[model samples]
Target: MDNSQKRILMAKTGLDGHWRGPTIVARALRDAGFEVIMIGMASTDDIVSAAVDEDVDLVGLNVGGHIDVAIRAIEQVQVARPGLPIFAGGTIPPHAAKQLEALGVEVYPPGSQLVDIVDAAERLTGTR
Candidate 1:
């Protein structure tokens, strides 16, 4: 499948008013020819709903506040759509990154290159 056909659902799991990371990632994904759906500062329920309703191929989470919140959202999304590839970015510390990775989510910490993110999107969505 081509990049255009693949959809990525992005959500910020916290009320952290930081939209720069996800915004930049979304723009990169769009420029790379993928459909990027961004639901900024969303609740866990909203995230799961969007993931299911949008039929997205991948989920990009912008985690800021608590890791448990992100964990809850991730678990719900996995149950709602099994095997949906997920990756996360933001002010995640080392411990939280380990937790996320333990749940099979690829983690991109601060200063991760945009090309790497877009490349991961392609690899995860199988659009490469």
Candidate 2:
């Protein structure tokens, strides 16, 4: 597959500046041949706008805030782009992961493997 054919929009949904996780994941995705757009510290509106404007195939959120905040952003993304698959990763607790999962957002908390995430992107984006 051509590496440039796949596009993913990555964002940080809170004030957290810890970029290690997202950075590593983004690199893995990019190296795997997916175009990744990283938007650090973005609000719900910003995330939505980028997802739409960029015409990305998937949305990845690095959540580091109250679950409600992440939920709000997820909800907004759903409303704005229904069926636009979204996945999240960060310091989310087990319960928070469950909540995100319930809302149809795939959650990959700390310690998740990069290969796993990249595989998920492929599956989610129908590239696999």
Among all candidates shown, the one with the greatest lDDT: 1
Among all windows of 10 consecutive residues in model 1, the one with the lowest summed lDDT is 16-25
lDDT of 1 by residue, 7-109 (tens): 9999999998978888999999999999999989999999999999999999999999999999999999999999999999999999999999999999999
Q: For each candidate, what is the lDDT?
A: 0.96, 0.92
Instruction: List candidate 1 stretches off by more than 4 Å.
Output: none
lDDT of 2 by residue, 15-116 (tens): 979899899999999899999999899999999999999988899999988999989998998998889999999999999999999999999999888889
Clashing pairs in 2: none
